[model samples]
Target: MNQYLNHLHVLRLLVQRELSSRYKGTIIGILWLFLQPLIMVIVYSFVFSVIMKVRIPGMDSSYHFALYLMAAMMPFFAFQEALISASNSLFANSSLLHKSTLPAILLPLVPMLATVITETIALVIIVIAAYLLLDQVSYYLLLLPFLVLIRLCLSLALGYVLAIMSVFVQDLRQALGLILTVILFITPIFYPVDMIPTELIPVNNLNPLYHLLDAYRAIIIRAELPGIGLLYMAGFSILLLCASVYFFQKTIERAKEFI
Candidate 1:
């Protein structure tokens, strides 16, 4: 009980430090967090809606592209940013490997928790804008908190494994950039899953990120419950989380020597 209490106290401080330091000394301050998503949304809207003249079937409006992109991009930006930061967490704090008294798992989790909080705040602005611009809001928006929780779990699970691996294979940093780029294009963030060939459905479903991005769209845009796939995603993430910790623990002794 005492150890659990101490862990909570330390995690609280670490999250605070991570959040504050993240935006510190920036010219735009916290607005910096929203900037990247904002730019992506604009670029996608212009290229897809304006140039390509693409139309999402159920959505009929001048701003449908913006709405479509916003719904999918919100959680995705959070997932991508959080995962990247969390994956690099161990390396960023390599010096603290032997020196820190707190649990090492807390290292990746700090960025995960910090990104959740920051993105939640930034998301509110995007949601409000979409509601105003489209004049369409669903009661299903109420379920978004639950969906966001699932996204957080999935991000943390993949992040911990990568964070540990990156310590041994420094090449992961460069390779991760290319991999995430391919994932972005393949994950249906800029397009709809219905466009995917029927043969590809199973492969796409296996991505886990596909489930998350699709769930966000389903709840916010489609205004429906996330499919049963989310249950599978939640299960996979928990198992992955367990395995990652075991792997990290077994390898941690050797990892410290390298660091």
Candidate 2:
């Protein structure tokens, strides 16, 4: 128990360092945390919900699409942001890598936890707005914590691969940016899955984010439990996590050489 508590303290410092460094300089450092996402919420909500006027079948209120968009955006943002940050975590902290005997596995976690903390705050604001405007909240809202855990594991798995690869191939950093862009457009972020043609459903099924978003939407927008299919995806994430940890440990020793 004491050991676990000590790790928690270390984790806290890591997360704090990440936030501070990212926001270094400028007049409004930490406030940007609240302001930036809030600004994104307003801008995206305006562009899509107002100008583009997108709609989903299950949504009833005029703001329903915005609410749905925000709900889905919450997890996806964390997933993408955390994965990118985790991918760069090792290289970004190269100095720290040489410092001590701390577990390298813990490095990627800093960004994940930092982003989760920031997004959780944004999510609360959005959800409260959702409840106020729509007058409804899902019992599945209770499943949010579990969904977060799944997202963390999924990002961590991917992060392990990207972080190691990045040390060897500098181009990977830029390549990852383009890849994440393609992923964003491919995933049904701004649109509904049903909008896709029937023939493409098979292609859509191949995206892991597709299933994660579906399960997330079940609770966030529909107030329904995720289908049993979530179990399969959860299992997939577990396997990926185990494989990633092993790969990271094996290749990590050589990472410093490339860096």
Candidate 3:
């Protein structure tokens, strides 16, 4: 019991350090966390809504599209950032791992926790924007914490798997960026899911991210409850997390040698 508490304390400190180091030399510091996503949201909203004139079926105006995009983007940004940072966690912390008795799992966790904190702030901004811009507030928004938990589980599971694999296959770090880009374009982020062709619906269902973002949109944009599929996805993510933890533990010793 004491050991678990000690690890939690260590994890908290590591997360603080990870977050501070990310913006240490910058002028605006942690404000970049909010600004970066906000800027992207603004740019994408303009390009798609103003120039391209994209519109959703039920949503009346371009502002609704912007709000929809913001809802999806915050979680996706957090997921992408967490995965990328956690993937490199082992390599980045190699010296600390060798010098200290800290659990290697904590390395990936540092970045995951930091990303969560950063994106939670971003989500708060989105909520306020939704309330102010759209004159909308949903009781379903309360479910966001549950969805975020599922996202964290998914990110941490993949992080553990990738961090261990990256030690053996150094090229994975470079390839991951391209892979995530492909994932972003493929997932219905900028576009609505209804725009997807009927024949491709089954294939799209295979992507876990689609379900996640769908749930986010349902709550944020439509003020509706997501379907039972979200529960199933949550269960799958938990199972995958358990498997990843087992894999990470089994390979961590060999991974350290490579590190």
Candidate 4:
């Protein structure tokens, strides 16, 4: 427990440093936190609902398509930001890695936690606006914590593994960015899974992220129970966590030399 607390202390310092460096000379500064996602929601709303005219049938709630999109987007943005940030985390903090003797595993976690914390605050405002605009909040809203937990676990697991590999191969960051972009669209963030062709359903369902967002959609927009598949999602997250930590611990010693 003491060691865990020490890691938390180290994580806090790293988070503070990253936030400062990220917005150091910017004029608007942290305002970007709210603006970036808001802007994305707007752009996506325009492209998907307006231009593309994609239709989601089950979302007959008072919440419009925009609200539905934003609901799913909160976690997706967090996942994407955390994954990308975590991938480059070690490389970004090379100075700290070389000069400091803190737990090396905590390096990737700093950005993952920072992104999750900042995004969670932003999600609160978005959720309130969504509920107010749509109608009374649904009971499924309670599942939010579970959804967020799943996202964090998945991001951290993937981030830790990537961060360790990045020290050896700098180009992995670029490759990961491209892969994540493809995964984002492939995931049901902008569209509903039901719209997917029946034959292709299996392929799309293969992405664990699909089930994660579906769980949120069930509780928030649909006002229904999270499907039994959430157990599968939880299992997937646990497996990833085990694999990532194992790889990170084994490879971190070599990462120290490369950094």
Evaluated against the true structure, the overall lDDT of model 3 is 0.87
Query: What C-alpha lDDT, on a 0 to 100 scale, does residue 168 get in candidate 1?
Result: 89
lDDT of 4 at 154: 89
Error of 3 at 85 (Å): 1.0
Evaluated with lDDT, which candidate comes out highest?
3
Candidate-wise lDDT, in order: 0.78, 0.81, 0.87, 0.78
Itemize residue pairs with steric clashes in candidate 3: none
Query: On residues 99-178, what C-alpha lDDT tens digit does candidate 1 reach at each position?
Result: 87878878888989887886676566556656776665778778778777888888877887788788889888768878
Query: On a 0 to 1 TM-score scale, where does candidate 4 land against the true structure?
Result: 0.87
Off by over 4 Å in 1: 34-53
Q: For residues 67-109, could you state the per-residue lDDT of candidate 3 as single tens digits?
A: 7988888899899998899889998999988998888888888
> Which regions of candidate 4 fall more than 4 Å away from where they truly are?
1-4, 38-55, 58-63
Pick the TM-score winner.
3
- What TM-score would each prediction reach against the true structure? 0.89, 0.91, 0.95, 0.87
lDDT of 2 by residue, 1-259 (tens): 8877888899899899888988899689988878876777677677767787776776665577887788777778888898789778888888778795667878887898887787777777676766776786877788877877877888888988888988888788778878987888888877898888999999988888888887877776677899776777788898999999999999998897876
Which stretches in model 3 have alpha-carbon errors above 4 Å? 44-47, 50-52
